[model samples]
Target: MHIMRVIVILFPLLLASSFTDACLAAEVLTLAKDGNAKAVIVLPGGATSAARETGGILADHLKQICGGEFRVIVESDLKDASVKDQRIVTKSTEPVETFILLGEGGLTKLLGATSADLGPGGILIRTFPNAIVLLGPGKTAPSDPYGTRYAVMTFMEDSLGCRFLWPGELGKVVPQRKTIKVAPINFNYTPRIRQRRIRMAMGLGERKSHGVKRLGFTDADYHYFNKAAMVTTSRDGGWANWHRLGGSLRLASGHSFGYMWEKHKDEHPEWFAVQPDGTRDQSRSPDRSRLCVSNLELIEEIARDRIESLNKSDLNSVSIGPNDGGQTSFCRCDECRKLDPPNSRKLAGGGPALTDRYIYFWNEIAKRVTEVHPDAWLTADAYSVYSAPPVLRKLHPNIAIRFVGLTYTNEEKRRQDREDWDAWSKAVKKIYFRPNVLLAGRRQGTPVIYVHKLAEDFRYLASHSLVGTDFDSCCHNWATQGLNYYVCAKLHWNPDLDVDALIDDYCQSGFGSGADAVKSYFLRLEDITNTIAEQQLKITQPFPPAVIDELRGYLDMAAAATADEPDASKRVAFLRSGLEYTDAYVAAFRIFREHEAAGGGRLLKETKQRIREALDNNWLVSRGIFENHHLAVNVATVAWGSWNYFGRYYWSDPSPEIRAKVESR
Candidate 1:
């Protein structure tokens, strides 16, 4: 088994190295001085969405390089003729300069490459002087033909120095070269991890703060997600809308306890959770509300409602959960208690661990639904009190356990996570990790460079039976969080890629003349967080006055470096937006400190105004109302926002209470 594992790992490396050597040693293809080549992008017939999208991307990039002209030939077009003969002959009877083989199927069959041998998301790019063959695992894999698209993307990145940093047109960085050059190239790659999902914050009237544009995320973003199960308009349009571009419409929780109780409490009191007094209570708190899962009738009703709800849309996967809060909200009914054993060993949350009962309930629903819709996948958040793996019974293969991450480096927390993940990996077929990097309220200032820590965590995850990762990377504050966001996106595709070198590429490519200044700015801020700050505190917490001043100086240097170049100047402006937010935050704290020290002074008016302005600015930025694209929800107010930035900043109508008191005096 160990020998087989080594062979599997070394084969791709050997193939890639051989290709690279061959390409480097010989230069057979040449771009005519006239800037045109007899080249065509040949793709699979009756291609899937991934094939069509990738075919278009190859055609577009080829056209750009070939002075706005390139042909795309589908395999169906060459049905009667030999593909080899067609490539060697053209309508003009002149020798065809290049034949760019794309996708799998008839086109790849001409090259004798099969889907199974290529494996899932595996890609092979072999560039001859005259012909370039690109192959991706074909249509058999529905979730991601990640190979073809990632091949095209990596080709552009390696040869053309192009990058899709985040999403949308604005996030893409295309080089300003005028002509095409031909070089021998051979590359074969397969993603180390299977699933890479980024679950951003989304809802009605909410503007996406980071990554893609407002109301739309293009196919470009999907290229970064190979095994992402989240539905999108580009593919799964029935349950999803193009408004937010992409997100899920599946059931999040089995029962909305508040809504259920309001309707059924009086008529069917037995359906409600029985309190310690043996009678049912109808009250609901933010976190403490749950239904009696062990009620046989209740479980039956849930299964019926779930199937009905899922049938409304064609989405294949559903993420079901218990209530909002942690473990304590679980029903303590006699039957419910019979399902869960009291585990004093649980560390994160107290009382009985709920893994057994939750798993049992979820498996029941999954089994029933899958019987009807055989491909249906039922996912549950193994979080809060239910974070531990079920010891009583093995999980159904159709059921997926999603373990949430509270802190990345917390030893005890991660140790518990390791145990849970290892156990679940053995019991179930799929396991997903959702770690909080941005939403955890860390303020490492602009360009949050946690490449070291994130890279470390991802490497560890790859060794385990990690099928997918859903990073809760909400609020794309490019100025402060841009580096972190880019790292997160890149690492998802190839976790073993060198992170520091990637960081250097980002700094130099994104900010040309200001690269050195920007690199210094990010590294210095990272130094403070990694060295000075307490691990327990968030990276977003306010630094001391001296640290704030040091940060301001870094931004000042960055601005000066990019003063002459217009493009770099624009990029520097993005870095400055983060500085502006931080400055306002520091000023607000300073004013409050002075007011408190003086015991009521004229400074009260200024302090209130600063905080109010900061709040208002943050709201505008969060909604994409501001001119700057690289803005974040003011970290100062994230605690109050609670993942609802728009609500906290806009509709909540919160006012400075200190102002009211000062005015009253």
Candidate 2:
């Protein structure tokens, strides 16, 4: 896997290690030479949208690299092929002398490589004497095939040193060359993880923000998420390339039984949780409610609901939840408690874990659902108190669990989460991660660096039961935590990729002449987080005043190094803005904490106002260089956001008094 992305240039030896002249001699296709088009791109007959889109992207990139007119045409447009023998590509419909054929069809079948030979999400990029085969199984890619699209992106990055780091023009990195070339290549790759989902802020998935504006999030929160929606839906196709690196596997990961509560509260009240005082617990919101997992009738109803949903629609999986509120709020009914282990232990978040009962619940649903539709999948949100591994039994094969909350901040909690994941891996037939690790820096990020930890998890999980991952949100704070998402996308597709090399590529391509300094700045930031991870800190607790100065020095060095380059300089300044926010946050948080102790209303108001101003300034600074809407709602506005008032806040417009108290002074 490490050698899979080998760059076959002179410097290719650095990435691939194994080098021989045999590679050079095997080079069958000469794409361009002396700034002139040497070959035309020919798509296989009856190409799908995947083939056409990838072909167009390849053609566009080749033209940019060599300043040549690389015409893209379908195989049906080719001249009559009585000469299928030696050079079928020699007489393309276009005047080009050679052709770079797309996809695995007549050309590739003649060469002995085809899509039938590969696995799901598998890619085959073979260079023949007259054409290059780029073929893969085009399934579940938001209407595009990630396999073939990934093949094209792989070529652009490894072969041409072009990178799609972030959205917009500034994040794009393409090396200019007078000529473009390819060596003899036979590469076959399928990502280690099956469903590689990296969702950006306000993406199509999980459309709700957990008690945000709909429940009382501020005007800022509303504006931020509403605007963040632009990237995923952008007409310019900026976010499309990033989507190529991800899978569109619809493993449902939300509160699932809200409709059940709404429909059955009056008729089947026993299906719901029972409070300590014996009244059946219920809520208008599914997240605010709890379920009595021991209710056999309730389990049957859910299974029946899933089977009906499956019979009607082609949805990938249906989610089953223990819902939002934690353990103490869980059903204390005798039947449910009977499933608990004799010596139930408390987890870091407080739990005589309900994981066993939830697992029992999903396991029961799996049994019932699979009886009706054998292939129908059930997704269990193994979250909250039930987030840990079940004590009783392994999950049924038809059930896939999505483990949320990889606590990256507190060392103890993170370790427990990983251990729980390891345990859950053994107990479940299928598992994927959905960690909210990015919330470490709180909302207005400190550019928290957890690259190594993320690398470690992905590498380890790929070998385990990891089917895929759903990183909570790709916080569009590119200037701050973009590396997290960048490295995340690369590793999701291929877990064995060199983390250091990916970071080097990111720093060098985006930061230009200041690559080394920029790299150091990020590594240093990572180390800062690492050093303080054991402290069990919250929000600004990890960042120190002295460290901010040290980070500023690294940015200053990068600024000096990239002074002659506008794009690189602006990026450095963009990072500086994040650092300034971090600096301001630390100070503001300290003041708020001090005010908390002294009961100083003046100091608290001053700190909240300061945070609001800093957020506004950060958004202004990101205008030309970055996406402005992703300045988080919860973590960023912690001192004033609706998170603190989760149960009370509503999505309606705030009253003058409520807005002043929570959002303003």
Candidate 3:
């Protein structure tokens, strides 16, 4: 895992590279004659070896830069040496005006302390005539481990005069009298591409699965691994068909995709997911089937066969999912009833009951999987009903939990979603649950709007100590989701990332050099989008009409900013595209207000007609094409509240004109 990058410097043999160099050479000659030479070098414990190596490099560079006699010492062995020895060396050392701590450890030791001894009049209290603390090229000085490192760095820099400098800044040697602006290079670059290696067992119905397999995902999609870093894949999966497509696509991609096979529910009536009301899950009926984990035999067979099959495949791990049967009524079956007599109340919801059974079953399965593939990771989707905290299982140390938070609809619901997240976060951290947050959109709907909401969620999560956050675009059809995914992944990898700068970089990388215009346009668009969001929130609050007017004034200003951009095409396109959302919100708000005024469903028919008209408008079609085809489709899929109306009124019994317009599009 070690990578070496070297920079080489060539100095002119004949001295006159620059006037500054000539003057420095003259000063060095005079200084050397005076015999006023001083050098102090310090090295840390863990990086003592590296510090010594770097010190040699620095000494060579320094000799070239200063052209004066200087002694350089590398103290690489004191990291493990006794404190008494360190004290004796410090006390016996000659007083040197110029001191350089080669690494954090060396600097710490020179200050006569360790991190644990940070008190008043401690290390921070110590001062030298001229001191240079060198942080290694890739290493960062330790900050508050319990809080956000950026916050800690900011606090320290503001409260103390301790300047943070990067390795690049150390290339030049500075005189004791000179003042240098220490600009620390922020190490927060988001990689253009990243890969995640997943090892999990997929429970497949009868068709496949000798056991679970290892898999790889990159750029928010499944890919086959040629090496540890490189992955290749074809078409991403579609809605309601992720499992089937994910398996074959994963395998075909030359990556390890795991699975566990079981008989189809139709063939195994006894193993079908059961509901609290005794009815089976019919959501996405016929396409998806559930499994009853309340049956011990079923659980055992899944755990044993799945693990075995996975071990036999190229899969790095095994993943278990959907488990829709768990959402059905809790198994009132004699066997399940007896096992949970004292805890019946705990499994109140059909979802919770099913999740409990699945978790209990998987715990056993995880044990079996570990026996064979000790290094493999297990993934269980804590999605839907199981997304809440109390229902999720306390997984084994070897198992990892992927908390898929997709059920929430809007920002308000997302705020509530955080409560569930808090519960799950506490549980996982308390039990050392290795958790990854999966912010996903519902399969078929306008939930695409949730992407904006997710940006806020990602920011909040990044502020915490979570391992990482993964954005589920579902597939390429919803490619607009890709924009959100890319942004979230970039932020997740490095929380202190400059998102606006990233947008600029993304535009340049994806488009070309002249795309700076587009970058600027989008940045302004983002600003306006945020402004509108704030306005929407303010309007929802119990503000006076005057306050509301003030908020609208702000919105008007935002609108005006984008109204006359240099790129008329981009401006018009963006504004025209946003009009549908704006119009929809206005119409929805009007209808809601009318209903309140009349104390009933006032103008319900008129409101429905306007919404239908908006959907049927060619603008919607044009917007879809401009944004990307999948964007509209994904949004429509998640627009169930509105879709129900469109489906019934527009599709089922449409008028000739409306039908013709829709068909033309």
TM-score for all models, in order of appearance: 0.74, 0.83, 0.47
**lDDT, candidate 1, at 489:** 69
Best by TM-score: 2
lDDT value for model 2: 0.67
Model 1: per-residue Cα lDDT at residue 348: 46
- Model 1, position 148, has a per-residue lDDT of 68
Query: Who is ahead in TM-score, 2 or 3?
Result: 2
For model 1, residues 501-591, the per-residue Cα lDDT tens digits are: 7777777777777788888888886665454233544444446667777877876777788788666677677667776666544443454
Instruction: Estimate, for each residue in 349-379, the C-alpha lDDT of model 3 and write its tens digit.
Output: 4422344554665577778778877866666
lDDT of 2 by residue, 507-529 (tens): 87789999999999999978777
Between candidates 1 and 2, which one is better according to TM-score? 2
Report the CA-based lDDT of candidate 1 relative to the real structure.
Answer: 0.57
